[model samples]
Target: MAKPNLPVFNSPEEQFQQLRKLIIERIIVLMDSNFSSLINLLYRADVDEFKLKKALAENPDNPAEIIADAYIQRQLQKIETRKKYRK
Candidate 1:
């Protein structure tokens, strides 16, 4: 009998980059079509409003990239908090 091939997994860094790219793409779409919804999402996600505003002001040419980065950082912070408190 032939052995079945196992699915290959991406490295953590690669996985993270893929996710980041997807998020940036989505953010760009939302920015163009439904900005209020994007704001609601960021609010619900608990990304720092002040930092996000500052980033947007500083990098007005790439708001999607800034928003994606803030969202990713906020998620990472939440994960770390959960792990730290799970004990």
Candidate 2:
């Protein structure tokens, strides 16, 4: 199979810029809301600043991936909680 070519960003800054856009896009899709409302929700969302900072300190090159992974993990936890409580 041929490998697909992807746009490789030049720097961490570029990667994080894309990451923020992706996070906002996902939030909008999930909430069925506008950019302004989603921005407010993102502000209120449970993104751990401390952990983000720690992740940046540990692996400065992949902050965007770290944050995205955290978001995925949080969503999975919510699904698990709902499943457990719906019994």
Candidate 3:
């Protein structure tokens, strides 16, 4: 019998990086075509408004990267909290 193809698994760090790149791309598209949607997403994702604004101001040329990093950090925080509570 032929062996079946299996999905490749990435390390956690690699997976996170891939997700971060995807998020940055999406944020860039939203910035160009629908900025309000990006703002709404940031708010919904629980990214700190003050920090995001500050980061954007500091990195005026790379707002997408800043926003994506903030979003990912928030998600990681939530995961940690959940793990802590579950234990």
Best candidate per lDDT, number? 1
Better of 1 and 2 by TM-score: 1
lDDT values, one for every candidate: 0.87, 0.62, 0.84
What stretches of model 2 exceed 4 Å from their correct place? 1-44
What TM-score would each prediction reach against the true structure?
0.85, 0.47, 0.81
Q: Show the lowest summed lDDT stretch of 10 residues, model 1.
A: 1-10
Q: Write the per-residue lDDT of candidate 2 for residues 39-76, one digit (tens) a residue.
A: 45435666566775787689977554565666666666
Which pairs of residues collide in candidate 3?
none
Order of the predicted models by lDDT, top scorer first: 1, 3, 2
> What ordering of candidates by TM-score runs from best to worst?
1, 3, 2
- Quote the positional error of residue 48 for candidate 2 in Å: 2.9
Q: How many backbone clashes does every candidate have? A: 0, 0, 0
lDDT (10s digit) by residue, model 3, range 1-87:
233343355687776677677788888889899999988988898999998899889889988899999999999899999999998
